[model samples]
Target chain A: MSSLVESTVQETSHAPAASVQSASLPRLGMAAPAFEAVTTHGKIRLSDFHGTWLVLFSHPADFTPVCTTEFLAFAAIAPELRKRNVELLGLSIDSTSSHIAWVRNIKEKFGIDIPFPIIADSNKEVATLYGMLMPGESKTETSRCVFVIDPVGIVRAMIYYPLTTGRNTDEILRLLDALQTTDKHKVATPANWKPGDKVIVPPPATMEDVEARLNAGYECTDWYFCKKSV
Target chain B: MACISSQGELSESARKMLAAMDASATPEDVASRTELPLFRVRAGLREMAEAGLVELNEEAYSPTQLGRSLLTP
Candidate 1:
């Protein structure tokens, strides 16, 4: 995935424009904000993941039922994410003891060991900095948010949900596949894009390029909108 | 209406509210549907009413035409 991004057009400007949209949420093609936090593994900094893809996600708290279900889901998929060189980091406004206890509970009840470090954001400074605190939901807890950051510190994707729901880990993995595919091929993902689905060719930025793209044999609704069977 | 602005298109919250509307649910059931604070639920209900997505009668609530249209499973 990192290599794919490297081959794409050297678009540094796209990253900053994406940074604004992803200011409070995770935005793709933008740098992830740096942070240092205490985790189950020990103190770690966001910079530690300087050269690897990262999935930095948050949960409201430990021992809660919904969060328990979500962590289990993430745990189930951790190995698959690891195969893709994506490190997973979980966060919550809980103490270290609380996080450990929750991990123990998961192990005992679900018979699954959470393979990744769960950040114990006791003070929630990390949560606040990441805009995880949704006052409309609960001031004391964080919402379910996922940030995908590449090796170069650019945020590649973000997903957010209201506190009522758990995230779709399937969707996250699908998105990763899609983003990687697009970066490698200079294409895009269509609606409900899955791993093997046809890829979209990014619309050209100029009239001549648009005609050239049309002549390139991509499926186009109009000259301005073109998709490829990649 | 813009798809993004439509309440029906907001699958995240719409799913939660629909799950809460079950007759078997109690106040605790409602709370479990979404992790929202009590005030947020009240606010959402008010907003839904204004959007013609829900109606309140006899201290109970039910989806209106617009809401039902959005909840088509």
Candidate 2:
């Protein structure tokens, strides 16, 4: 699946940007753009995270109040993500040294060590690739963006926040759990769903399925809308 | 404590390394025992140490009391 998407990207990379629709923010279900970057922990590539889920997020800049709180929130949930085989990678248009210093300062001030690797995108190469930079907002800073990529490198979900707002860490974790649960059980999550809650059963595809589902022993609001304990 | 709840949060590789570790075992010993690559063993050890489940002393690695409790039940 990813190979097909990569070939498509390769074919388009040579074209002039003005000639084609500017490759805007990657859409959901597309293969995540590949990149090699210098991070606070070490040099890493997208493929380095193969076979694990990745939450790739971008912040505006370092040492800011909102970004600091978001980082702390992300750090607080690092262990929970680790339990689910998800790795967090942060990005900003900052240098590696600046990133190191900011992270050190955060550790010292907050007593919370950020366990994730933060990409130093001073040149904006990674930011450009991910379409994290919103020129209308601020040319020099990345917008608050989150891309959740699955184990196979396909982007599954994304969210963007304006510069003035901070992200909700709980929503991010809930989304991750919902995606994983859907993938594992082939069920859809209802509104305000959380782990251990009943899940929505896939709607019936045919009349035969509808008939079978009517007596399938599920908690059925209707044949088309059923809930199950998955 | 967070560490106690985090006992169930170790990655598969880290858990394997923890299971393979004994008193005075090195990262190399863990790699050999678990048949994991050396780099993976090292990474697992680092994560385990950070989680407060393992300790390193005099070039050897061993499970901390917290880590032992994780294995108990």
Q: Assess each model's interface with DockQ, reporting 2 decimals per model.
A: 0.01, 0.04
Which consecutive 10 residues in model 2 chain A have the weakest lDDT in total? A1-10
Q: List the residue pairs that clash in candidate 1.
A: A28-A156, A30-A155, A164-B34, A164-B35
**Interface C-alpha root-mean-square deviation, candidates in order:** 18.6, 9.3
| Chain A of model 1 scored by TM-score | 0.85
C-alpha positional error of residue A193 in candidate 1 after TM-score superposition, expressed in Å? 0.4
Q: On residues A6-90, what C-alpha lDDT tens digit does candidate 2 reach at each position?
A: 3434423432331233245566766677666667655556655656799999999999999999999999988898788788999
Candidate 1's DockQ is 0.01
Query: Native-vs-model 1 lDDT?
Result: 0.70
Give per-candidate clash totals: 4, 0
* Candidate 1 C-alpha error for residue A144, in Å: 1.0
True contacts kept of 1: 0.00
Question: Candidate 1: lDDT of A89?
Answer: 91
Superpose all Cα atoms of candidate 1 onto the true structure and report the RMSD in Å to 1 decimal. 21.7
Error of 1 at B59 (Å): 68
